[model samples]
Structures are given as structure tokens and as C-alpha cells.
Target: MTASAPQVPPRVRVSEASLNVLRSHTDQLTTAVNLHLEGTLPWYRQLTTDERASLRLIAQRGIMGLVNWLDNPQTRSLPLVNELLGSAPTDLMRSISLQRALQLIRTIVEAVEHRLPGLVPVGDQQGMLEAVLRYSREVAFAIADVYARAAESRGAWDSRLEALLVDAVLRGEASEQITSRASAVGWGSTCGVVVVVGPAPEQADAAFMSHLRRQCVRFAADAVVGVQGDRLVLLLGGVTDLDTGLERIMPSFGPGHVVYSRIEGSIDQAHRCAQAAYSGHAAAPAWTLAPNPVPADDLLPERALAGDDTARQMLRDAIFAPLAEAGNGLLETVTAYISAGHSLEGTARELYVHPNTVRYRLRRVTDITGWDPTEPRDAYVLQTALAVGRL
Candidate 1:
């Protein structure tokens, strides 16, 4: 069975003389609480003059609220106390932690309890003391509620800002506004940034997002997460080993190929990384046997086949241009090797050269382009680069 809510007690009935006495001593009580804070709390003395004045005003409000509650015990104290504390400056509320706030409440309670004998008739003093204790308890809960709401609001705002920053990076909008937004979300300037793209988990709720963030921190990296339709995009910074870090957080993604981009030197170049990663994710299905968590550059042939201009240009620059620049018939021999069904003797026959000469040129091609024409996969990439270069 569900538990019932606690019932609030009826308001205490104090005489008019006692209520007037409490009302007349509001300023005196406020000053007494401030003096007690200065003497008992070392941190209270460190506040600036304006902060101290703000605290004085908050304390006065609290005392005035307490007096009004004592006059009419039927009045609800929670909203009244919340309204009183809400008048405090936001910075002051943050500067005074929950523990410090509780201490401040204790100080006020003690100050009131000490003055009860002079403020009330002996017969009514006990009731007044009990009322003060009850009101202080309500004020404590109100303070906690206020801080909790503030924290939740801040978390929500940061999540939206983070999503916007990731979206900006994906769209290649590296403006000053992106930089400022990045800074606002605590994106560090550390180098070795990368973008990882994959299918988002089916249950991409707040708890899952929080777990994903914890995983990033576990690997000593800073990250921003964005969910676009079914895809999850993660921008990670300060990763020393991309492979190991991705491996650790692989479970955070859904069931699909997880593709990451090359390590960028800085965050400003993250857009380039994001472009490659996104292209790779789109083209990942073309290669059924490709490894999960594959590098975007490793999928250049597929990306090029998918009509990615950036991938086409990358292939031309990294493979074709270098081979063309390297002399000794390197480009011509590799072209003939691929065209001749990757047969060294056929390439030698086509070029009217010895097989050994064809072999030497193919080795040079491997050394220059880092793709061995002898390997079937590398052979396909070389063929694609050759075709893209001619275009």
C-alpha cells in the first residue's frame, strides 16, 4: 500500500503582546544572527561587503517571515519561507552551500530561542520556542528544494547547449560563436580531438546519457554527445589512444558499426574529423566485413563510391597525387597492375617490362601510398583512387 502524506500541525496560538514583541525586535534579531554568524563561522567573514549586506537582508526577511508565521500559525510556512529565501542574490545562494545554509538557519534558531524569555510571557515561552523549531525545519526543506531545482535547471540548459555545439561541429560551422559555445560548455583546448558516429541506443534517455558521460571521464577525455534521429555523435577531446578509448566506451552505443575519424590536432579542426566520420557511417554498410569502430580514412573507397566529394578529394591527395609525383613509372605500373587483374606478369607484359621491374614499382607504390596493390582490398582502393584522380 502507498504511504499517506504527513499532515501539517495546526498553527500555534500566541497572544497579541508576544506577537508585537517579536515584530518590534525583527531588526535586533537580524543583527544578532549576523553577529553570531561572524563569530561562529570563519567563512562568513570572507564574504565581500556587498555579499554581507545581502546576507543581512536575507536574514531580516527570514526573521520577518518567522514573526508573520507566529502571528498566524494557520499560514503555510513552506511557500512563505521559499519566497523569503528566493529574494537572496543567486550568487549568494551558490556561495552559501546547503551545509552553510543549514548553519545559518541554526544560528537564527539559536538567537531566537535565547531571546524567547524576554519576548514572551513565561506561560507562552514554551509554545513560542516550539513554533520557532517547527518553522526552522520548514525553512531547511525549502532551502534544499530551491537548490535542487536550480541544479536541475542548470543541467537541462547545459544539455541543450552541448547538443547545439555538436550540431555546429557536424555542419562544419567553425565560427567564433562555436568557439564561445564550446567554451561555455567547458570544451577544453586540448589537442587530439576525434568524432565518433554510430547508431544511438534504443533507450537513449537521461540515465543512459549520464552513463555515457561517465564512461568518457573514465577514459580521461572530454566529450559532447548529440542524438540526431537514430545516430549518436560524440566529439571526444584529450584522448591519448583512440582505439583503446573507443573500445572502453563501445558498449555505450547501439548495435551497429561504430566509425571514428582521424585524430585532429585541435578542436577547430574537429569539423573535418566530423565530416569524415559521418561519411564513413553512411557508407559503412557497403563493406559488410569491415571492422566495428573502424577509422573513417579506412573507408575512403566506400565513402568515395557514395559520392562524398571530401572523400574523393582525400583519395586523390593521399593516394593518386603522391603516386603521380613519385617518378620511375610507379603510377603507370600500379595502374597497369590493377587494370591487368593484379597480375604482376600481366602488368609486365602490358608495359613491355620484366616481372621484376613491375614488382619493384608495385613495392614503391605500397611504400608511397601505404596501400599494397598485392592485397585485394588495397587493390580496390587503388583502383578507386585511379578512377577518382582521372575525374
Candidate 2:
């Protein structure tokens, strides 16, 4: 069965109650826009029925938040619109009213037709200046009010929404709706998705975010964008792991060690995939994304650790297997050997052992694992495996 249709909100109730405070502001806006347009508007001017309904639905979504903020002490100052406006906004804006709001619109249109110096005049030229200042202040506050409510809303519901959005996307049905939804949720047009595991920001601090964005850009020059969360899902449509890719980008990200997940498709799709790649249970790689259906191997802490864990079943066979078999400190010796790039002199200096002793242990590793350091390639592979295993 088809899902039930969304409830249609009554304009009267919305304008008078939840949207009451915004009513006067809306009236003011209507007057301002009309004056600029001239007095040719028909009576009963309002958003087209469809636009009205859409705006109302959007407003109601916002109002639910306003109601919650009113109840919250930490967020009490959040709804300034209610204090500035009211629950019973005047009907002056309704076309049937033909009232003060309409009068203001008429006045501005007349002034414009008469070639008034500016858009709207308050009274005398002095009033005009004052009106200009007052109008500007009101408009500025209104913009700030919208953002305040938005930021508050994001804090309360974004995690759930992000998850929902991701599901909708993965289903392959909401591609067109994605951008609009992202904007509604406060993901700015110019943004990035970072996948970090150590910590996620409780609040996206302006300077910290700027630093992150700036650092990412410095490396790629608009090559990357991100959305912050448990995984810093990133969209790297602009950079790749080509010879100069990392060279052209990624210098500013001071080296604690990080990997850029690869993505394919439009920047927007890249944005989504970046989240998916990082969101999955693995550590990202320090290389380019290989292609569609991305690798099944997720970079995880357990897999990246520094030992041969693939055959743990053999452990009890030797009562700790290699651990017991090594007898003293073979793991430590091998670790040092790997870190020193399998150089006998370096491992000896680090371990305070004779270089000959380092060689003997290296030979022993070959005996146990059937992998030998005598071949330089095997040594490199083992070292990388060990590093990830440790991670």
C-alpha cells in the first residue's frame, strides 16, 4: 500500500501560532519586496499555493525545533523570533485584509514609480536613513535567527539524519534529492567529509574547521571536501595517487599519518562514497581508490597489527607457538629488525647485540615463518604488515 500522504498544515494556524513571530517579519519582507516590485500586484498576494504549502511544511519542521528549544534551559535564548513576533500574527498580510502591510507595499510601489531615490522611504529623508538602518538591522537579525535555529537543529538531529540519508542514498533512489537535503541539514555547499577514528568534534569549531579545510585544500587546491563524523568521510574528486597527486597535494597535513580513501563518479557521488568508505569498519589506505565496488578489505586496527596472526590456530600446538618457540625475546628482536629496515648494523646498535647475532636471529625468523629477509622484497612486505598489525 502507498504510504499515507503528509498532513497538510492549516495556513491560518501556522501563520497565527508557530509562525506567528515570523508573521510580522514576513509582512515586513512582503512589503519590502513588493515596494521594490511596484504597486502592480493583485490583492491576496502570497506564495503560490504550492510554494505556500512547501514553505509551511518547511516552517513546521522548524517550529517543532522552536518548541523544544523553548523548553530547554541551555537553549532558552534560541528562539528570538518568538520574542520579536507573536502567536497571533496580524492578518494584514492576507490579501483579504488590504491592511497596513498592503499599505506599506502600495506606498513603496508608488515611491518607486515616482522615481524615489532608493527602494523605500521611512518618512522624511532623515526617517529614510533611520528606516534604512532599522530595516538592515532587522534583516541581519532575521538571517542570524535562521542560522541559530539551524545550528541548534543540526546538533540535535544530524547523526540520525546522516544515517537516514546514507540509507536512502545506498538504496540508489534519492540521488537528485541529496544536495537539497544536505543543505537543509547545514552541510555547506563547499564542504569536506573527513574520516577520523581517534575523535570526532563535539562542536565544529570555526578555527579548527578552517584549519582542517585549509590544510586539505593546501595539499590539493580544492581537490577535497568533507563532512565530519565518526569517520571523516571525504570526497577527493580533485586529487588522486598519481605521481604528482600526493606531491601536488597533502603537504600541509602534518604527518601523524593519514590515508585518503579513493572515490569515483561526480564530486557529489564522491562525497557519498567517501563517507561509505570511511564509515565501514576499516582504516583508510594511503593510496588511490582502485575502482568500482571498492576493495572488500577494510583497514581495521586488528588487521594492521605487527604480527602473523593469520595462523593463530597453531598457537596451542607449541604452547604459545612462536611466542614460546622464540624462547626469549624473538618478537622484540624481529620488531627492531623490521624497524631498522633489516640492516644488521642498525639492529645490532639498537639491540646492543653483535651484528652477527642480528643475522642469526634473522635466519631464525626464516626457519619459523618460511619467509626470509635475505630477499629484500619480503622484508619490505613484512615491515608494512607489522606496522598495520601494530596499529
Candidate 3:
């Protein structure tokens, strides 16, 4: 017999007091959050484990301060924040009440979808998500109450912690141990890293960082910035190309986000690449790129330089060592001969000397170097040797 699919438990309705507490706390927290910056949100004190997890998701949305206003906190936070501030959040609160059930459904749906995007919907999530959402609302309300009371104490500590976070990333002093510990906490696969150099025109030492976050929903990527040192060094993970990383970031700001861009290399190579990128920009030099790793099979600069180094050097040095010791005249004469197409008269005319004088010098060079100018190949060899020796 075919067993029927498990039913999703219905949402448990949230109490009025719980809802009021949430609203009040939201308003207070909204006031508490300093809106001057982007990435530095205050450390979420208090709240149960479930609440913290929910807040983290909200924070991932880029504006943890307004979780309820934006249905999809990941996408709609900024615009919704703008809308709420322009008028008021009361209407927003009321509007949210209408979609509470829908929001609960979305939460469960997202959880399931991430593991299996195309799986048939199961109703089990409905009840569980409802419970989680209610718990989160209550947590938010509790946080709000704390904010109202401990605004000064909480804000200061949170700010300090946030600054520390930014500082640690920038310093590149992050030890393998710390990095390993963070890995223990389980960060997802970041194929590569991009270091964003900020162009803060207002101050001498201002910088901006853009940490690229991938939306688990659409798998869309964008940068979230934090302050680093005197500049902002944004660490963007999950992008392969630097250009693609910048493109992902630029449009997310929705226009008026004009600035220069240069990408640092992979996550492993970020420190060096970041410094190089910054130096290049500051010095008006070419942007430094961290070349991707290659196999032994790939040709490189040293490969291109390969050839009869000993022979080439011996011949080249034998030709010019005498001239260099005495003066640049022989060197000059040889260059003139090549430029004149190894023609006696042409070499003389170019050097503003008699053709006989040019011929005598060529003869002397042939005797000393054993490289006869008459041999077209010998002349070519001399020319190439001169060029390579200088380099």
C-alpha cells in the first residue's frame, strides 16, 4: 500500500502581547541602530539560539534593523528601509500582520528549497516555521526591550566588537588557528576572494570593504563592506572573475555607485593582492592581478627566456665587453651598422664618419669577436645578443 505524504502542521497564531512587544522593541531598536554606516551592525546581544539564527538571516539581508518590513529581507531591505523612514513603520507593521502567515510559509519554503530546490512541497514546514517565526518575533521583542533600557551600554560594546571584526580582516594577521576555528564554524565554499579598494574622496585614510555574499535563494552575489585599517577592504567570496565580482556589486547599490575597481586574487592570496591593488591605485599604476595558479606544463616567463644562455652570453659578451670597457663607441658603431642594414656606406653615413672608417671598425670587431658581419645570421645574432644583454 502506498503511504500518504506527511501533512504540514498549521501555523500557531501569535499572541497580541507578543506582537505588541515585537513592535515596541522594533521601534526602539530602529532608533538605537546608528544608520551612518553599511556593514557594521551592532553585536546582537541576548536572545535565544533560535533568535540569534533568525537575526543572522535577517542580518544577511544587509539591514538587520528592518527584518519585518522587507518580506524578502535579502532583497527588499534597503528599499523598504527607505520607504519606512520616509513616512512611518506603523502602516508597515499593520501590513506585515496581513502577511504573517505568508511570511511563515516563505521561511519554511526557503529552508526546504535550499536543500532540494525542485522537491514537492511538504506541509511539515508550515507548523515548524510558524513556531520559529513566533519565537523570532518574541526574541526581537525582547531585544527591543533591552535596547530601550540599555541603549548606551549595549551600543558601545556592539560598536567595539564590530570594529574589531573589521580590524581583524584587514590586518591579515588572522592566524591559521583563528581561520581554522572560523572554518570549524563552517563557512561555505568560497571559490575565490576579491579585495575591494575603496575610493573615499573625503578623507586621507578612508577605505571601504565589500564582502560579497551569495543569496542562498537565487544564488545571486553582491558585496557587503566593512572598514579595514585606514581603508575599507571588502572580501568578496564565491566569484571567479574580478570583473564579474565588481559587476555583481555595482548594480546592487542601484545606481550612484560610481567608483574605481580592481580585484585582488583568490581568498588564499588576498593579503598580497589587496596590498598590490591598493598600491597600484594610489600610485596611478596598473592594477596588480594575482595570476591564477597553473600546472608545470604551462609555459612561463622563464620558459620564454630559455635558449642557449651560455653560447648567447659568451658571443654577446665577447662582442661588446671590449667596447663597454673602453667606451660606448664600439657599442654605438655596432648599433649604427645594424640600423644601416649592415651596409658599409650606410653605416658610415649614419655615424657621420668615412665609409672606410666603418669598414675598419667592422673588421676589427670580426677579428676580436670572431663574428663576421658578412654572415647575415652572425649580424642577427649580434643584434639579438645586444638586446637580451641589456634586458
Output the number of the lDDT-best candidate.
Answer: 1
Model 3 C-alpha lDDT per residue in residues 82-110, reported as the tens digit of each score = 44333222222322332332343234334
TM-score for each of the candidates: 0.85, 0.34, 0.30
Off by over 4 Å in 2: 1-35, 38-132, 148-255, 260-391
- Cand. 1 Cα-lDDT: 0.83
Candidate 3, pairs of clashing residues: 8-123, 8-124, 193-267, 207-231, 207-232, 208-232, 209-225, 209-234, 210-234, 211-224
Clashes of 3: 10
Which residue ranges in model 3 land beyond 4 Å of their true spot?
A: 1-166, 177-186, 201-224, 251-269, 285-391
Candidates' C-alpha lDDT:
0.83, 0.41, 0.43
By TM-score, the best candidate is 1
Q: Pick the winner on TM-score between candidates 1 and 3.
A: 1
* Candidate 1: residue 6 lDDT (0-100): 100
Clashing pairs in 1: none
Worst 10 residues of 1 by lDDT: 73-82
lDDT of 2 at 114: 43
